[model samples]
Target: MATFTPPPTDTMRAKLLLAAREEFAAVGITGARIERIAASSSSNKAQIFHYFGSKEGLFDALYAQTLAETLALVPLDAEDLPEYAGRLHDAAVQRPWAQRLVTWYRLERGDAAPMEAVVASNAEAVAEIERAQRAGVLPRTLRPAVLLGLVVHLAAFWSETSPEFDTLVTAMMPARRRQVVVDAVAALVRR
Candidate 1:
């Protein structure tokens, strides 16, 4: 199940979540160790089971929290999608672990039940894009969902680039990297 709410108020639960984030990011869900997470957080196995039900549950909680934090940091501006993409790229650059955690989530839980928080977040953004399109703010050539997908993917260009890509753009500054994302989205959503 997905964690749709903020993290638990209890201190132990919060610590476990914090510790699990790093552990899970480092080794991924399949390779993560409950014992290490428990010990790192100064908690124990029984406490982890009690708080999150299982390792998968702990991952869901962390992933949900991560998504919430990112959304709160850079909310969708459907009418200003280029800036939104640039902001997302900046956030990803600052919080590389968030990207790693998301990568692990997609790899490990691709077949799992839909995350309620993710579904709700994407739904809200899509609705906003639709509203913008109706008002002739965003282009209508591409579907809202597809446009959202393109913007998000473009924002992750650097993060998803290959070693060859890194070599080719070795001199690209941070500003240029972010502009690449912003410009791509602008081209896509131009009215």
Candidate 2:
């Protein structure tokens, strides 16, 4: 007979974390139901507590993980700001999870700890921007945080949200117009 080995509990807990991220991104923490999150992970509420201590604890873990993951996606190379911009634009187009997680965090304001993840991530990006400015790749006057903000906040408007936004971008705008808008933003960042 083949021996059977159970998957590690941490592995199961990790699944819960991922499910929580998706759920919180969709529903916001206030609106996200624990049962649904559990159902998605094929776990129960008791297991959630065992892993995270509580729903709020689960939210904190999700928020931290989401911030870390999103920050990891940022391209901070001085020579590759354009590529970075393109990457960010593509992320907005491709991975809506980061934006949704951020939206949920902003709306819920659930984390009790200081937003250290944000400051750390931005600081690293700022260091990279400073390098870009020194290299004359980015404009000397552009603040890294401001540039990052523009990339994230503006791209988010187009990428996420109501059906109206999708209709306007998908059905209303001509292909040329859509391309033009994207090009304009890229040009603004490059200049």
Candidate 3:
């Protein structure tokens, strides 16, 4: 007789995470069901509880992982704020689930501790902006944090804010929307 073996724990955990991400993105934390996640992952509810403790715990793990991935994929280039904003915009468009996850986090878990990596990365970007200001590359009138906030917001405008605006943009050619983002960022950051 052939021996029978089970799949690895890590593999099951990864599937669970992926299924959870899709579920959370579609319906958010409050609406997501453990049964559905387990069904989608080809695992059981007991395994999810064993791996993540609870639904909230699973969401927290997913949030942290998403934040780390975002930081790795979208590093700031303070010397070129326009380019940075464009890259941020592209990333937001490519991985829209990240934006939805953030929305869900803000709506459902406002009191949760923020991902440290995101905070640290934002602070580093602010410092870089200040350095660029001192070097006469960027304007010194705006506060560093405010400038960073504006750039980040502009990049995420289409994804996270204003469904009506998104509808209007959707009617335009894709390149036009992309150019609009690039031009807007350039205009905002120009000295």
Candidate 4:
């Protein structure tokens, strides 16, 4: 009998990313072990270093990947800020690990280079909010950047905030939590 092997490609990269994501989300970068990531991915530490250069490099790659994936999947709807916030809340709920990964990134690598994609996306969103404000759809009192930040923060409030508060909020149904996010965003942007 012959042993089988999987060819190396993006699939391997994805497996490593997924494994690393779980590890990092669970214990953060400082505490996550490359050995565990390797074992989980059916890969080895050498491959991880070869692909990402180091543990920090792997974390950077994973952070970039997570941000891009989230932006692509849960795009902002400038035409409807409340709906956009609701969708963001839904995305946070559906991919709870993603918010945790982001939390880990902030805690572990606060001084790292900003993800350019996220910066550009935020710029675009700010521009859209500005347009909406000028068109009288959204209130002009608040700065566009501030409005965007508020909506984004509202969407991830429970996940990124205090664990004790999160436990209480989690007791409510997901729909209620989502509604709260949407309502908060709506109130902020209301004329």
CA-lDDT, candidates in order: 0.92, 0.71, 0.86, 0.87
Cα-based lDDT at residue 103, candidate 1: 94
The lDDT, on a scale of 0 to 1, for candidate 1 is 0.92
| Best TM-score among the predictions, by candidate number | 1
Tens-digit lDDT track of model 2 for 1-191 = 99977559988888999899888878888888899989999888988988889887898788787667655776555565545555565666666777777677766774456678667877887787777777787776657778756655544555555886566567544334435445654676665
In model 3, the Cα lDDT at residue 169 comes to: 61
> Top lDDT: which candidate number?
1
Q: Which of the two candidates, 1 or 3, achieves a greater TM-score against the reference?
A: 1
**Tens digits of per-residue lDDT for model 4 on 150-186?**
9999998766778677776667887787898889988
* Model 4 stretches astray by more than 4 angstroms: 1-6, 166-171
lDDT of 1 by residue, 1-191 (tens): 88765545598888999999999989999999999999999879998999899999999999999999999999899879999999999999998889999999999998999998899999999999999999999889999999999999999889888898799999999999999899998988876
lDDT of 2 at 92: 61
Per-candidate Cα RMSD to the true structure, in Å, reads 5.9, 3.4, 2.0, 2.0
lDDT of 1 at 101: 96
Going through the candidates in the order shown, the clash numbers are 0, 0, 0, 0
Model 2 residue 85 lDDT?
Answer: 51
